[model samples]
Target: MLAKFRQIKTSYFKLLLLACLGFFLVSLTLLFIPLYISFQNSIVKSVSSHSLKTLSQTSYSVEFMQESANTVAEQLFFNSTINQLLYALDYNDIDTIISLNTLNSYVKSTLFIESVYIYSSKTGNVSFSSKTNGSGFEHIDDFYDSDYLKTLKANESSRFIPFPRITSNDKLVYSFLLPSSRSSDLMFSNSIMINISAKWLENTYKSIGNQQDDMILIIDSNGVVVNQNAYAPVLADLKEDPMIVRILNERVNEGYFLSSMDGEKQLVTYTSSPETGWSFVLLTPYSTILGSFANLKTIIFAIYFSIMICGIPICLIVTKRLYVPYSVIQNKLVDLEVRYKSNHMVEKQNKLHALLVFPSPFSESQVLQLKAANQFKVRFDQPYSMLLLQIDRFADFCDQYPIRDRALITYCIQNISEEIIGKVVGAESVQIDRNGVCMLFNQTSELQTRLTPLVKEIQQTVRKDLKLSVSVCVAESGHTIADASQIYQTARESILNKFFKGPGCIVYASDETAKKRAGHSEYQPARQKQLTDLIMVGKFEAAKKLLSEMIENLKDAHYDYFSQIILTITLELNNTIQLLEKANELTLPFQFNTFIAKINNMGSVEELLNLFFRLFDEMDAQLELKKKSKNEKLVQEIIGIIQRDYRDVNLSLESIADLVHLSSSHLRRLFKKETGSSIADYISRTRMEQATHLLLSTSLSIANISEQVGYVNSTYFFTLFKKAHGITPAEFRSKYATT
Candidate 1:
């Protein structure tokens, strides 16, 4: 189970599914949070605004009614009949009945008034009219809400005040008390009380505007509910209530707020009537405001939950489908990255090579190449030196190993060199060619002390592991990146000093010995003329002696001058051979071109000296053979004349015999007896030999080549060339030119 859990945790499918689900949830949250906030704010604002507006209208209406009540009270207070009835000390049944009729008439004049009372404090008699009872006179103490008389008498400063009272019919009424006199002794004065039914006020409050579950109240300055539509009792002390407390503390004539009342949230809007000192409070429960939002929220949540329930599987399917291509692309990207890394390394190697081989005082492209190499961490902007390592006896090395082994061997050398050098300094080693590996060393402090030991160690390691030898050429320190190419070239040139230094040696380009022999040449024209003179006069012993001495002398010189010495010698020998052939002087059968070709395969100067000695012996043997045969000499004379005149297209056997001072028939018989072919055949053979050489060696057209080879007809020459080499001249050249 644990393993399975681990597998699931690491699974690509699981990761993708989780990612999709996370994104979906985050998107929903992002969309829902702000939407919820905005919707809630809008709903609250709308409900509060509507409730405030209703409260305002209700307050205005109540204020209007209070003003109307004040107007009625003013008119009633000024009436002489009501004043006479209240101030009269004694009265008959007629007078009392007339005063009751007047009170009844005043009550009937207003729609909100239920009854009116006129009280005479001197007699303690109250005359009252009611909608339910006929007009009558009674003591003020015996009246329903008769305690209001005490409340009215106690307030001296108030000429008129409103009070709530309950009648014997259990109906609510608001009584407005008006004094008949302004004297401070209110008990001695007459007063009037106008009763307004709470039912009428409630109906008026409802008529203005109200909502179901909405509470409306009219609270007086003493924190008592003057009129109650809902939520609180009539005349209840509601100052401690949360909603009422906030409303009262606001100290503003009108305002709205949200509060919690009876464990339910409510929007409370209140307005105060300045004339009545009564605050109109509207308590709207949040349930009413959020009712529509609740339905919308339900629908939205249902849809959202359904989508979330269905989206899991959809996300799974989508993740599966997407993961296929994603996996493939990821794998392809990995492969591309691998290839890119491989190509990047190769590019770095190529750029480093370009920097090493670039000309001095670097060009723009070479500078760019160096900069590119620096990007690869192959920096040359610091002090550095070049080490050129060439596998000694590279020709022999090739003869021993196959191509694969050679590559591995080269790689081994480069790895070992770089690894060892890397310990002490920053270095980059690149295999420049088959036999050469170049290393750039970035640490040059104590230059000689640092490089000498490291270079020797690298040589020792290569020789010990590979059982092969290498010659290392270390160039002088270069101060800047631009000096790398020149320093590398100097190392390359100095490495050739290995021809004298032999294998498994390190040669410094800055060494005094190497510097002294930089441009000095040991071989001279006088030595060549003397060697040629010895070979021409049939003095093989003296010529052999002279050749050995020259080879010995060249061994001590630089390899550059050594090569020049060999070249001059070979050229002189060819001239001497041509001189001998022309004068019929020494008929030495020397293949000089073949001999020159053999020089490259020589591993040592001793081998080269031995090769030259063998050449002299072969020439001596051929000279003795020529001296021994007279008939052979005559046959050779005829052959030589034929060879000399092979380019003369008109030359024949008779022309050849005339040049040799012999008759045609006799010359033909002598050539057949000694050479085994006719003179005419020999001439054709010679011309064909020249034609094949010219075809392979020159780019001239076949017609011009044919003319040079004594064939004026290019077609005949082409046929002969095809027959000789089993291919046409063009085909032969194309086939062998690249090789």
Candidate 2:
């Protein structure tokens, strides 16, 4: 038994050696190069796709977080408790200790505030407290005082005031200011300061998740790193990377770059909080995620080698069986080819390889002669109508289905086409194009009568069976394959006509109607003259009437030229009316009503024509007056009252309404109708204008400006200013120097 087993093993070893050699040869000839290329392409595509998805997700998360932070900041900046505390301190009736404690407690509970401080400009007193320690002003010189406080006071409309500083403990902190709500006439103005801790920022960064060793950082508009998880990186070190610096300065929301810290390539996604003027960044490393695909390549290679080894013996076994049958099939195919060439007739060719060409009816004599000489008969001689069927929004359909599913959809369409053609006029060849299917039919006069039923049947098949919608266009019977391209063009026109008439209906192409509609003259000169006449005198009512009349005339005549003319006139009239209304609301000292009256009273065509030129000049003058009077005061009585009672804590539209002896709603309506601005907007604008002058000229701090401008909360005041000016008061002052 042992000797017999050894003999069998020797025979198996010889076969295995032969199989290995064949596998190596086949691999070298066919599989290795193509398989390696396909593998590499798949790996690169997969990595790129995942990278893009990760970048997109990271960008969305950062934007969402930044928006949340801005909302929280806005709420804290507008809180009334901080406003009252600052107001009391500015009045000098309360001690700093009491105000600071109240503010610190409010900050701790209301916001994620870690520390609070109050700085006074008059007494040079600064009070500060944190969860760990409480401190009072030790040396007046120890506090860094610049024009920053004065600037903040001057502009009461700013919300978040960012200042970078290194604390006594040698840790970087971002200090935000909340100015006091006190009048500029007061001797002192108090400002609330909040110190943001790195730990507090850790809470914001926690949402970014772990993306390798890459760290998330928050930076201000000035490129200062306000919060970073990485250790000991200065503004200069952060700016060393050009992309990071660009993101900080330009507020680019999402991008990719290489880090300077470790020289590792990364996809960096960023978003700017327009409210705070700070940027948030999320950085992810590339190699950490894409490296795993390398292992996949090794596995693919092993499977490919095994397949090649197994395929060698299988090919050897199949070759013997296939040789005799393949030789017989090859000889038969050669004989058929020779017979087809000698006959020179498509019908004589084998069924599998036959090509069917529909000959033109115009060339019937020559086609018949060729067919008869080759022992083939003409299939049909009657005139035929053509139908073009197409799907709407085909590109959208392609996007919804995967490639394999799309192939199935095409196959289904082909099957349906065969079924329809077989039922109507026997099974015929159908040509598929990018838009839809093209079919030829032999029944000439019956096309118009039978087309409706056929179309209904096609619609039912597509909707009920294939779950798709299709539109069909049919050409008249006089058309044939000789005029195939022209017939197709007519069918396309018929489909477009359905867009105007309604959908799921068939249209027959009429050459006479098409030609008549195509050659009409366009009238432009008369329409232009009419529009110019109405706009010059600001006769908006008459202009609207003339435009409506023109549109009706275009529709009645069914002229494309008139339609174009009416569209142009309507657009011009709308724009002119809007301009005139805007000018009147701004209280420009121009007689637009008088000019309109003159245009309306014109008696002759010549006079009306002359008015067109004069109207343009008058409209131009009104626009100039508008630009000059944008800040003009038509309602001076209301303006003076608002300025006087601006510091009143209960000051509002209602209070002003009572003082003026009118109802609140009535006053608001009248103000907006005459001024083109709502009551609240007018008040806010007045306060902001006053605050701007004070910031540039006065020595008052931000708190005084807030009270002087009628804002009970100085932080609210700053928030409003930053929204208007696109920067904090201190930054605004640095940008624009006052003499």
Candidate 3:
């Protein structure tokens, strides 16, 4: 009857186990559905976040430009000087020139506006443009009055006009027509108009794209491409995509969706700008994003399916094999329990190690009871000392040795220390942490003196016998066994001082105090200079060593004081470097914001030193490169400025200084250093060159050419022309003229 009942019970247990395994597998598989859903949601969220950020950046850029336009228009409406200028432009009287001066000032004050025009229905058109010569209106109007303007004037429904045309040099020019202000009768009355280059918009849009596959489209509300441009060319019409049509019809402000067009899967994002009522569209191939997900899902499903196939048979076989041996295993467990109870000495040693390493706050009576309970217990009658041995270059050691070998090495170190110290005095060895071992021993005198020789023995054994280099530090003697935490803390601090002392040297807490004569040394100016010199010379390791020494030697160094010192050095370094950058018009590759974030997270002096080392190393390399290129870049900038604004009568050293954010004397020195010519001489040369080109190439008159090349005085222009070309302006033009 008993045998039959056992068989039945075993069969029932196997069935029960099978039932639980099936339930768990079913529940796990059910969870995958929600997991997949969550993953899908996460993908959408990530894509939307990126899309929204792109939308925000693009919108901000457009709004920023539009807002700048609105500022000028706002001034045109509100400023009496500007308003009077536009209204009196038709008279061509004294106020007409005053209005032109005012308009020129506006163009100079603004960044992007190249010219300004005022139109009156009663008197036709009057314009002030930097590109024009003289107080000219009709000559400037010759080319600008294209059929597009005529068509735009016929409707006047929109103030923002899009016109992209190729210049004579084959460069595509972006042109926009902006009406400056709104009035009650805008079409019939007076109006101010402005012309600006739209190249900045195209460049800004192209800057956001990354690869050859990406495309940027500026689409209107009617789904037509208003502006055609980007770094990469779009091969397909995005408006015809079903997802884009759905997004437009849904009137979603901003989002991303996957679509297919021309047999290519595409990821499309669209956002409508509040200022223009036009949508900004970004499109890339869907394969770029979702290709990895497909493989990931397949691998994940394969793993789970394998587990389902393998789990049932393993459970069944294990259940069938275990039941027959139940009685014999139960008897062996009882015998093992008896043997475990009999071995009190080993258990006591384990208890002692546990109490030392883990938290065990005990009263004197409780401590006494614990001492009585353990074979390797501490005797409180004598003073105690804690010696901590830390593995030097522990990470290297870990990487070189396998786990089992590392465990054996640790055991060997512990056994050697215990065997040596246990013979001489009452000492217990414990593995306190990875790459660290603690020796808690009772001594009759100062532990530092007594344990100094023992540290040498342990070091020799670890190096000579075990082949591991260790740095050991011994703490001051404690009065009782209960002082383990404090003693261990001091010993750990002694090991921390090893950051200053190079590895393989044993250190002691007594030596640390003796080194600090005062609680902390005052922060020094010479040390700061030394730190800067080290960084400037690119001696990063030496700088790190010096910083660590300074921190470890500070008299009662709190984290706040050390942090302030570190931060002061960091910020001062930044300020000094930034001043250099500004003077040279050079930008370093170091991201200051990222540096600041890492600096803020540094919790210790060592971490701060490490961070500054990296920061300074990168900065030093970039600064070296900048130094080599600084003068050349400055000279090139001056040349570019001269090329762009050679027509400005007011172009001078001081004006160029303000434009390039450098001192006039500094710009002069650098320009001469780089190009062997002064800025003034270079500007003169540039003007003469352009003047000669105009003389040879175009039909512009001599006085017009003089003004166009930055000479307000025709007589002075003729004199310079003689000096530069050995001929007068008319003579030069007559000599070079074809007709």
Candidate 4:
């Protein structure tokens, strides 16, 4: 046994295997700890991402409901018949009943609507569907009593705000007062409130939430906590909540935070709805995300323990074989080294994922932590170049392919780009987003010279293989790793503006925009006036064509110059919008702030022009519709007035026109065009119809019936009445009498 022990110790293969085993065991301490932590992080990150996505989907449901409410309100506001009804002093006639039918139609059209109320500023009497009779707010005090309601009333510019509910179970009613449009009548400025089911919203959230312990909250644009859940604290004001303040103050659209709440650790995921400006927040216990790893620790211990148990016999067998398996051992070590590198590369890819798609404001220390954890080969301090690749018309491509096929296409594109970029730039790349893949290369003396052809090569390869067009934007030289973010921004901006260059267009950040035209020049004042004139004329297509040419010419100019041109165009566009607004005497669709936000986001002039084109088209369509609506409404009003006061001798074209604030001549022409009859003829026809009805229904004398039908001259009334009916009123009565 002693001799055997000496032989085992002396065998080089046994010693070599033991040495490798010892190193591997030590690596378990160093590697497995981080690996376990990394795995834990991966799991937590995945769950949190899932929760955020689920919350976003739930928010979409809410947004869709809000959209329905907004659409209903907009339709009601623009309805001329509704306008006329609201303008009337009382709802005590047949017209009032017709208006009621119209209101009920709106309520029935939307499935989610629990109740709808229209509050008249003029009458101070509430007009709402009777379905809400027992639901409170029968009196306006039920709404005006709320503090936020009072605030909304005070602020003319307030958007749709959530009216406070008595409890969490109370349905959500987003209320708003229509701002005074071109119509000077007080009736047109009525308030609107739409109620949706609280149970539905709650259930939708519950279904989206994977965890039973999760809590959801929805706050509207007014910072009012519109949604009530047991887990959420009702804020006196939503701004009072630190999380809300952080979200608002920081100006981040969405993110996650870990906090100590109610003496336990909680993870909060929050996002803002673009459609409604409402904040959706979700709170879940930290243990739900972190404690899932308890079994992972046991599994890791078992793995290490089993490895230790298996190594003893292997070492004993290797001692007997000695040097025979040395080559095999070397090959195995090589394979293990490759696997270790592969693991590290995966970690690096994850870190890069955060940097690209999410672009968090990571500090230097955090970056360094990522560096150490990922073992990234590229140094931030080194001179670098960036290549941003965007698959052109990605939206259209997505619409053409199913999800699984699109995934394959994306995978193929990424693979091809990576392969070509690797060959060209020596292999450094990160897929930051689905359509956007970034390539990083250390700057060489020939880097700038090589960048153009290299980008084209990859672009051509993707096009050839996938039959897709991709636009490449290059940042040929970056000063340092700290500047990488900025370089990426510049490159991204250029690529986003690809609409101006068209599909498969290439842009370089270092070209004329970055280096040339540093000197600024002021455009002539008349230049703006000319652009404004085109807009005022509603020559949207013409204006856009002119703008396209201007942008193309400015390609060689500085980016600042391009921005100035766009700003000028935007300002002039606003001027034209205001002109049309004043002329039409109505609130235009484009709010100034909203317009500014849209313009600010647009990097390319083509994008701005496209937006302008859409808005202009909408304006044309809306204005034309409004015109037809007003014309039809004026005719209806004329007819309604005639029917209501057919016996009044004073009723005439001038009197009806005065009530509608239109000249008699214009009203007559418009009425004739709309109704295929002149005002005089329509009024006479209406009066004659009444006379015939009275003659048939009653034993009233001819003179009294003529007088009742507004004919002071009985002979003239009889003659005209005979001409209209092709017989005397007495004959018509006898011919069609129900009796």
Candidate 5:
């Protein structure tokens, strides 16, 4: 065993291992010593502070309990039986024995009293006792002859004396004294005794003691232990403990004292009872009080050992792999942060002034803000008009291109808009999805002053680059941006104006104002009445001439309503022209450009008459062609309806003629001329078409379809359907309706 021990101790390999182990152990100890000391000190301080807090709490609790007991005693002393005894002392024949028995029963049932006594200093009368014989207190005059009685007599008031021995129960009692008015001089002495059970005091002490492993005691002013834990021997000799003696001598209400008790150093914290003149003391052992810090030191040592054993090797391995990437990322991050910080102050200035360049959606809050900021009044609130311009053949352009190229085209259009408006007006705005731009100006004067050059610029730029024509519609001034959406709708209507009046033009709301003021002109009210009568009779040309004369008068007079009257006439002319074109497919060479320019320049009735005559001639030609085509289409539609319905057995040339409101022969001839076939042949073709549709679309057999199409014979229906469609019914069904 000795040789083996030496081998284990002296082996070179093992010595190297032991050396490493010792080095680690020394390093770990040195590292952890300061931590352990700090942890230990912290725990000690925490425990000490907690103990002091608990001491204060316990002291307060003791005082509260004592006050509660005093309240109970005061309530008991004022009982009806006790009050009767006080009143009955003045009457000699009041049967004091009955009252004393009543008081005894009252004390037993109502208060937690062992016994109660009423003592008279003048008559040396002690009327109550718990003893069965009632002989113990009969001669007890000197017993009540104490300093407390003297003090009570001197003060002529109530006094509470705690922890007095009551011989009736052989236990500590709390006594209350009130000067009885029935005394010989009404001043000497009055006293009351309430012998409380010692078990109650013991139970209160036990309650405070059970909160912690501490010794708790209740002691009187005379250095006797009234209530204390049975295991605490230090409290048995109160005279030997200077802290207790000092407490009694000093009569401090509350404090802490450090002293030796039963040869062991301890802490004593005490509080005096306001009700009973006794003090509650808490005694704690020093070593036990400080033992709570051990776990903290152990935890700190464990943490230090873990760091020493595993931390360094792991850190070194991780650092070796991470150093390069981490350094690169760190340097990049540092550069980015520095750049961001430096550019932060300059970024606001670099933001593009897009507010003026983009059209704002008219939201109520934005309008309110504009109003509040006075931007609306200052910028757009005056007699400012709106112009909404849209591209005419944009859809055709998009449909002709690939999606990517379409997007590029749209981008180019936006670029063109920016360029044109940016150069001409100096104030440019755009709404892209709507494919339009809005131009606001003070009035028609501003628009005409600024717009001619701008429109020329736009026409030149779009014609050169995009080869697209542009149409514009201008709304009269005095509307806000909130009404910009309505203006955009009006502009859409104006695109049709180009077709009615001719292309490449600008139209204004004022162009429609003339019709609104037709008969209101001063000259020839009779002519105006004649014009109304002619329009009612559908003599549109005569009415047109009269309206032209009225517009001429307003223009020559330059009346306040001239713009209004002219706009109305222009609107009426545009509508009449559109109607004529739709009915006749007529073409007009008159351009809206001339009308807009003439309206912009005309200052007399003769110039207005010239424009009106030009408009009327174009419209009359359109109306003549519209009437002819309309009559032809009506005749052809009647013939098609007759052919479709002739297969019904109830069908007749008369009914078919009636459906188109014509005589049977006339319908017959019309059908023949239009279709190059007789009515009977057309009916057969119609039947074949219905048969073919049913055969391909339904599961019904050929015979049923034949009957449904007014062909009685299935064979004939099949023969006719095949001749008309070049396929038999079964073949047609197989080709188109295979399930």
Candidate 6:
């Protein structure tokens, strides 16, 4: 036995098998045992919770129905028409008509109400309204469920309790009785009865119990099954059932228990509603309740055994391949260490970028990795300052260089920054974006006198070496490493307005502006309105001028505010053009979506302004083209109307505009644009020429000639004719109309 044991210990396969078996046993004990125990407990809790939730839902539905019925009853009780009808000793046909209409409206408006009935014991009058029958007056003794009055009188305390009733039409409804007043006059008081739909209640229960073995029911305090999902008849006594007897005897408001019903063990949950004095009960079979959990347990056991059978041999094979001599492993590890150190630079830059750009606390493991790599040669324990170097005219630069050239230029810029800033202080630099590189270094007192000048030097060197200008934004005074990201953000935002400041400029972000940036820019609605109007009128030059003014005004604003203003302008302009397009005035000149995308990719405010001008020019040309084609037809139409209506006395601008279906002001502009004269001038010219012809060709008097020319005031016509031909009408005829 000792020889066999020694051999087993020395054997790799046997030892591997033993280890795998022990690990499987220990893992199953630690993980599956607690999981199974918790699952067992949870199955019971889950079943009870699910059953209770379903019961509560059903109870809530019943309560909602009850409340709806009561609301209808209250409306009838307070109704002035009903009140007037009830108080009158004799019925006015008008009051009865209005009360019936009012009750009909109440019944039709409420979803749960099958009908509404109003009774006056004093006058022995009855009025009822239903969904099927509009409304009518009936004798109190002939009304359906008229005996409910006696029941209401008997139970004076039951103000809004519902009683099940079968109507004369053979429809089952739950009727609620509500008196007009709370005064102790039940014997003679008027009352309103609201009947809730029994089918709707049953449907609510049916929707809750979708499973075949599930049964839900609503029982009143008297143990009558008022509502049920089963085929059993409602209003039947369920108190004889053992489950119901036990639930009532327990007297708890809500609870669940296992019980045998219909010769099958089921989980029964019940909840009592205080509003309606009804208990909602749900019974789900025990097997169905635990069915999913039992399946889950079986799946878990199958997965466990399958892993044990499949994992052992695979693990052994993999371990056998991985096992090697110690010397060879040591040599391979040494080679891997060299390769890891060689490739860790990029990873270090990413880590540094995260530390500076994302303001999150680092873990100890992360800090230790940085310490071990130690490639960037920067320390985070001390205070630091951040700088953002953004390429000036970045869009132009991208257009000028290819991908490789751009990358090379970026590398050169970083190298220059490292050489320049690192000589003065401990520094680390990383390219954070395509056009921007960020640098962090130890803070010094000479931030303003020393570091600022060095940043300017770096900017100049980049411009000189790479022929590309860069704008450098330096953050505020010394800040802790934790606050590096905040300062970096400030610096980054400050450089966004490089178009306002020229290339190769060094700007410092002041603490005050950094805080003030949080404030919003004042929306210039007046200027925006002016801009929109100008664009609509096709005033390209004026719109361009206004855009320049806007850009200038917003030069000192925060980038967020400026970008929002630009977006607002685009949205408002697009909306206006869309409205015109809807009116068939003109189609959109440019694709608005593509225009907006170009605006977003713009590198500077000038680029944005120029793009706006381009859009304006396109829109202006479109408007001009449309105007030229559209105005000529409208103007000729106007001329024809003037010549035809010259004999009429009311040939005015507004009248002609109505004929042409144009606004008076718009017609005036259009005619002037086409004829180079006013509508009034054209009318005068037409009438005066006719007056001249009449004077020359016919033997008509001046007043007759004036009347023939559609002039009601002859004096005004003569004065206008004299003004036109430099003479009176007769003299003009004598001078120019003679043969």
> Model 3: what TM-score?
0.42
TM-score of 1: 0.38
- TM-scores, one per candidate: 0.38, 0.42, 0.42, 0.63, 0.31, 0.42
For candidate 2, lDDT tens digit of each residue in 594-642?
5455533433223433554454455556555543333233255577777
Pairs in clash, predicted candidate 1 = none
Cα lDDT computed for each candidate against the true fold: 0.76, 0.56, 0.67, 0.70, 0.56, 0.76
Q: How accurate locally is residue 375 in candidate 6, as Cα lDDT from 0 to 100?
A: 64
Give the 10-residue window scoring lowest on summed lDDT in candidate 3: 131-140
Clashing pairs in 6: none
Clashing pairs in 4: 182-585, 380-481
Poorest 10 consecutive residues by lDDT, candidate 1: 180-189
For model 6, residues 1-739, the per-residue Cα lDDT tens digits are 9989768655865665566567766886677778876786577667777778887887888788888777766556545566555556677687678877777777787777888777776677677788866688676777665555565566445568877766767778887877643224435556777788898887876687556777887788878888645725788887887777877777669988888866777877788988888887877787886777878899878877787778677767754654334666899999999999767867777887887678855654566567566665665665667788988767778889988999888988989998998777878888888998888777767654688779878988887888888888877645445676777777877776565566777777884365355664577889989987887666779989998997788876777677888888889888877765544333556667888888867767777788888888877776776567556656776888898899998889999989989899988887887778999898989998898878888888899989989998999998998898889887776787665
- Candidate 4 positional error at 570, Å: 1.6
lDDT of prediction 6:
0.76
Q: Across residues 203-267, which tens digit of lDDT does each residue of candidate 1 receive?
A: 87687667877878788877898775557788789888766777677766887777887788878
Candidate 5 regions with alpha-carbon error over 4 angstroms = 1-81, 87-94, 129-139, 142-158, 161-163, 166-169, 179-187, 208-213, 220-224, 229-242, 245-259, 265-278, 287-293, 304-739
State the weakest 10-residue window (summed lDDT) of model 2.
350-359
What is the alpha-carbon lDDT for the whole of candidate 4?
0.70
Off by over 4 Å in 6: 1-344, 357-374, 393-396, 445-448, 477-481, 497-505, 511-521, 524-554, 638-739
Error of 1 at 164 (Å): 99
